[model samples]
Target chain A: MEKKKEMVKTKRAQKKDNKWTQNDKVFLYILIPILILFFVFNTLQLLKGFYYGLTNYKGYGDYSFVGLRNFIDLFSDARVGKSYVFTFKYAIVLTIIVNIISLILALGLNKEIKGKSVLRGIYFVPNILGGLVVGYIFSFIFTYILPAIGQMAGITFLQNSILASTKSAWIAIVIVGAWQGIAMNTIIYISGLQTVPEDVYEAGMIDGATGWEKFCKLTFPLILPFITINLVLCMKNALMVFDQIMSLTKGGPSQSTESISYLIYNNGMSGGQFGFQSANAFVFFVVIVIVSFLQMKFLGGKEEQL
Target chain B: MSENMEKVTKEAVEGAVTNENEGEAFAKKRRAKHKKQSGPVQGKTVNRVINILLALGCLTVLFPLYMTTIIAFKQPSEMTNDISGALGFPAEWKFENFTEAMRVTDFWHSLGNSILITGVTVALCILIHSLAGYVIGRKMIKLKAFKMSYYYIVSGMFVPFAVLMMPLVKQTAQIGIANRFGVIVLYTVFFMPMNVMLYTGYLKNIPTQLEEAAHVDGATAWQTFWKIIFFNMKPMHATVAILTAMSTWNDVMTPLVIMAGTDENTLPLAQLNFQSQFGTNYNLAFASYLLALLPILIFYIVCQKQILSGVVNGAVK
Candidate 1:
């Protein structure tokens, strides 16, 4: 009887061990294919960008590498230079204004109020809509309402075509950008505000700190982490501003609003300057990385914190 | 007991030591308590004022939308003129503009194309993202050890659509799916970073033992994941579904680039087509814009909670 029991136990253990090995093999086999595909696709895309950047391949036949000529052309191109400046300015201004407005709005809405959630939802609805839709909607405002307001108020400040003037076009674009973007910033700020312990605020209140003092001392410091994140996102998203610019102005009124992304789109898809466009794209990618990295480093402080 | 008596005696001494200090502390406490009592009442009044102010502010936000919607129904003369009419509720509700807009553009055909493209993209996105997330989440994959692997996939997020447009268009044409399902799949891949982040974040909170128990009960890895893990991801699935659906549904740029060779335009592209076709008819153009926005508006109104919930959940992290 003892010998029979030992045999059965050995058989059961062997079956379980076999299953474990099989499961390991399955995992190994499946993972290999996924990893290969992921690596191959990503590398191909990156390599294609680099390879195309080096060659003057204008969407045609065999091409040879023209070392740094495209970069030279990029520098000399007046539109590219102006666009670089314009995009940078727009991004900086938008990031600052949007972050400030959102932080204020978040604080305002965070107060004790009924239907606050519903109001927040209403505010956020525009964000869910496409950038193009928002742009299209604003186009009507700039073209119609602004002119009407100018007529009613007897001021030619905005005029019929706000985007026609270089000075005002960038401002209009940034305002529209900020308006569309406030929801994301507000949400992030609210999330950050939630992390601040309630006792901290209570302590501040007991200390007889004024609202402004409380904001500058307690709220801003506590929300610095979120501030960094919101700034980074705002910068990146603004730098890549495309659809809104497209529907709103199409980088128009003598190309004052021509963002880098729009310029790339025009050169590559519209102009058929694939190689030059690829180089521009590479430069844009580098700039974005450096700017984002510098911002993160400055704000993140310690490496471990990031 | 001695400690209690000593604390009482200390309080008594404090009360008697400085009448001024006691009076101030007592008065301040009373004031604070009173303020706390009336805080909600005052808060409501302030909120009411704020709400009205915010509503006025929101009118500024909604003015353009209102103008567009109203003028779409109004005559061209009415639209071009500063007529004294409220932005909402035109004096005469005209249904003819809808039909006129439909006729001016190939609205039905374009709508069909948009729906097909969006549907295919969403389906492909859900499939690939879920499959990839499941394997990475549950399986002890070797390359998963290389932490950079996930980053490599996610790094595609920041590669702007413009950068990829030239190469993607060329590749899609070369592969002969530029205007077909290939475009859809590539679109799915283009925006997969957020999905991956969401799923990974979500999966981290789930226990691996559930799948392990299933595997122990004689199920394949895929089966175990499909039955146990994926089923449990209802909220995440709902959020991703709505988000990706909204994204693909409203996308204009991708279809514009890929579908340029053909009249296989989406609703947004169709609106552009309508604008060019009826350049003089601003009313028709605005009507076409309204038509394109109608389905999305309806969807948003119906699924407000889902849409808002998705935004809050995906964004807060």
Candidate 2:
């Protein structure tokens, strides 16, 4: 009779297992379709895109396996090289200017001041705008208003559209970029400021630390993680600047402001070199991946050390 | 003897109370000292200068947007002289500039397309991502292979759309969805991973006890998800919705590539074409920019509080 009872218990456990299997089945049926869709569109396409980098073709149709030929062409292509160089310069300048201005704004606004809330909203307005609109608006400013203002003030540098020249084009891009980018970074800095506890400041004061010393020792370390996050975000954005460049400068005055992203889009879609552009995209992606990895590692280590 | 003992005890209690008050006062004085040490030290002139500088910075930031507004309203003849300062209202305001912009862009049709595409994409993206997030965060954690897929999707965040544009264009065309609807599919596909990251991150923190209970009540998985889990994800829902909506509304490249030969055009694309077609007509171009900008501004104004709080909360965590 005891053996019979043991067998019966095993049967009941098996039945419970069967029930869970039934639920798993239902779950799989629900999930599989979405999974398939995601796979086919994103994962599958990503692999296929990488494959095109190894071949030679126009924007469509059959291609021969070229085996690093297109990748070789990427290094030799001066236009692509110029875009990469320009984008890097833009990113470095933007990251510094944006972080500084936003941090200053955060410091100023973090004080016990009146109208701080309203001022924050007003400051954040540019971020609410799409890049295209902001770009176009800034384009008009550069192409017309600034020139007119320059004429009025007798300033030689601003007599023509800054975007019309290679030297000034980058400066224009940086300005427009910072104009919009500062809002998000400022908000981020404010949030970061909020996280650094008030007691720490009191401690700094107790140590008789100067304002600059207190900031360097206390606030900066506390907000290091935020800086890292913002830096990475800023770098990525600066690197991928397409809309503003397209609208404001159109990568003009000799393709001086053409970013890698713009280069990929132009070459792949409109420039009629499918495999070559694909190779450019792959390299671009690899560079992005490496920089992103470095960013996380470099800052993540600092954050942990802090 | 009893009276003397009572008086001594009362005196002791009073002494303790006085000591405690003294200690509290000392702590308050210390706090005040810290404040006095760290508080602002700028003289009146310095303070005034800083405030003036900040105000000036605000004006400088506002310059381009201000120009867009004034230039949009000014007649063509006024453009040259009115460029002196960016702030003044036009003497002859061209309200018809908006009408002209609207006519040039085929505003109503493009607006309809944008609304349909963005709305449907946002809704579908939310549903699919939330469901996927729920499953991954809750159920799939136990299965190693399934957990790997979770990581895979998360890794997709690093790859920009430009990387896959080559194959993606062909793939969409192969399926014969290379138009307005195709653009929607791309948004849904590309925008999924971020929202999934968000939702899954959120759902991981939400305990499964309630869901388990719903399961115990003989509710099917579908019923339990709809009745209990989906409603509980309101904050994630809002973040995903607003983000997806904004990007879809503002997007130009995706539509430009997929629907280049097609008749369909979203507002941003329409605006771009309008600007080009009316090239050098600053008034109409400025007006077109404002018109493209108007809906977003209204959306911001309407949902300002929620958007701000939601964005801050979402990113902060």
Candidate 3:
């Protein structure tokens, strides 16, 4: 151990001594090609996406530069507007519900429960299946099983599949999204809970704190960082939610369940309006960046204060 | 007894005589009570209630999966039959539904395409991400440009691929790369940011001694990295590989837009086609879902420990 530390120190010294060397050139040789490939394939394509948003480009053939025309149409496009609203609602609802429920599950598992591991594994099992498959599974449950059970038991609301209605479709999406996405947040919360030292809880107990009180005063504040990470992640996933929505509703009973990603997909790929869809895609990217940034700044600053 | 001894020893060391007698008596009562049952009666009841609730929640989560498996085995006619509730086991299990669905899906060709695409994507993803992560992390070149390039790639993670993909629809058409190999290339470049993040965090922790020792032995930089640094990166690489591989395997939109309506069918696309082909046979549809699910489920069951830890680590970043 001592020798390792000493050797690391000398390496640091060597770095300062030589600054840059002919030997250092080898790393650049490896780095440059990867950088070039990324720039051409991923980053350059993003730049092209931005450029296409300003033009009259279709899927192919001829095009002309129609400055700001696509962006102008974006304002009046009723479907695009509805999708943005739906995406926001889905993101907000799913993030809040999933985090709350996941926190509860994490706290429950942290307690003195018999078969804690078994219960946790079961809760996390859905996460192993893709969002696509889980959506299909629940589609059957909602359409065939739940309604049949409801009809057999004389429950009117349950007898009608939730996906058939707009209001209930929102809830159904949350249910499926929460099922597939909750496990990771729960795991993260468990890890965050474990980080709170035992002595901290002991001190709280010494002052006669109740369970809810300890959670409010100690656990929540300490776990704020984990909460932020999970929140941002859930928000992003909910915003991009495509596979599940496609499998569950196919944006139907009348295009009511179409998310923003689905909107871009249907417009660009199916509708053959490449340039116009690229404009919508550009706005979607900006909205995500802004929302995530604002969330991180607000919550992240609060985290430091705690 | 362990609890009692700990409390007694702590009190003795503190020299705090206040409540010392009460503490000892309480410890004895606790030890005696421990032999009869665990904890207070009220707390036990509360815990039992919580456990039962948790168990119910687990069942609720597993219900859909349970339904899929049960119905997948039932004959097509049994779906509407009234022998029992839909949740009940099939009276007549027609496993032939799976074989029929398999035939319609061109299961062999679709499975081959999925394997080839995912296999090549994961191999290339690991190669580039690790190679880049290593050089940038170790600062072997000691240049500001390399670090800037690192953040440049990391920035791609925030821009939703939904938007990035819009232009590719046209561009790939123009270039005529929207085939099986085309989607493979997209997955390769698309997944780099995440892989790099994981590898960078890992590579930063490694000590410089191994590389320096190799240097002293007259080893070339390639030889040292391939032989020494790569071994230490195995666990992180496995984490990255499993995660990216699963996403690529389950991917639907990519193959749908790029490779669909052609002979180059990925599993999800094939399953989608199967739904249309056997529109009325719910049995066959469920069978296809199961077949589509089986491969990834098996992989996950085998590598779950690595996967769970990978998720936590990747998110905690």
Q: How displaced is residue A95 in candidate 1, in Å?
A: 1.4
Docking quality (DockQ) of candidate 2? 0.38
- Model 1 native-contact share: 0.29
Give the whole-model CA lDDT for all candidates, comma-separated: 0.72, 0.79, 0.79
Q: Give the residue spans of candidate 1 off by over 4 A.
A: A1-25, A31-42, A195-197, A302-306, B1-44, B83-89, B139-146
Model 1 agreement with the true structure over A1-306: per-residue lDDT tens digits: 565456545754775665545655665566556556554344466567767888898877778899888977988989999889989999999999999888877886777665677657666656666777667767766776778778888887855568777778888888789887887788778777877888888899889876689888888888887888788888988998888888878898798899998898887776868898888888887787789779978988832221
Please state the error at residue A84 of candidate 2 in Å. Answer: 1.1
- lDDT per residue as tens, model 1, B162-220: 66667767777777776847657667777677776677678877886576556556789
lDDT of 2 by residue, B1-317 (tens): 22332343344345455655645655665577667743444322234344444544666555566667777887877765446534456786557998988898888888899899999999999889998888777656555545776887878777888888888888888889998788888899888888888888899667776765666567998888888999999888998888788778888888888888787778888877876778688888888888888787778868877766666655655
What's the CA error at residue A264 for candidate 2, in Å? Answer: 1.4
lDDT for residue B30 in candidate 3, whole number 0-100: 57
- Cα lDDT tens digits, model 3, A1-306, are 677567657766777887675567888787888888788778787889989999888867788998999999998999999999888998898999999999999998877888877666667767767777678878877887778778878999988899999778878888899888888789888888887889988899889887799999988899889999899888888899999887888887677888999888887876868889999999888888899889888888878333
- Candidate 2 Cα outliers beyond 4 Å, as residue runs: A1-25, A304-306, B1-52, B85-88
Best by TM-score: 3
Question: What fraction of the native interface does candidate 3 get right in terms of contacts?
Answer: 0.64
Cα error of candidate 2 at position A302, Å? 1.5
User: Where does candidate 3 stray beyond 4 Å?
Assistant: A1-19, A304-306, B1-41, B81-85, B140-142
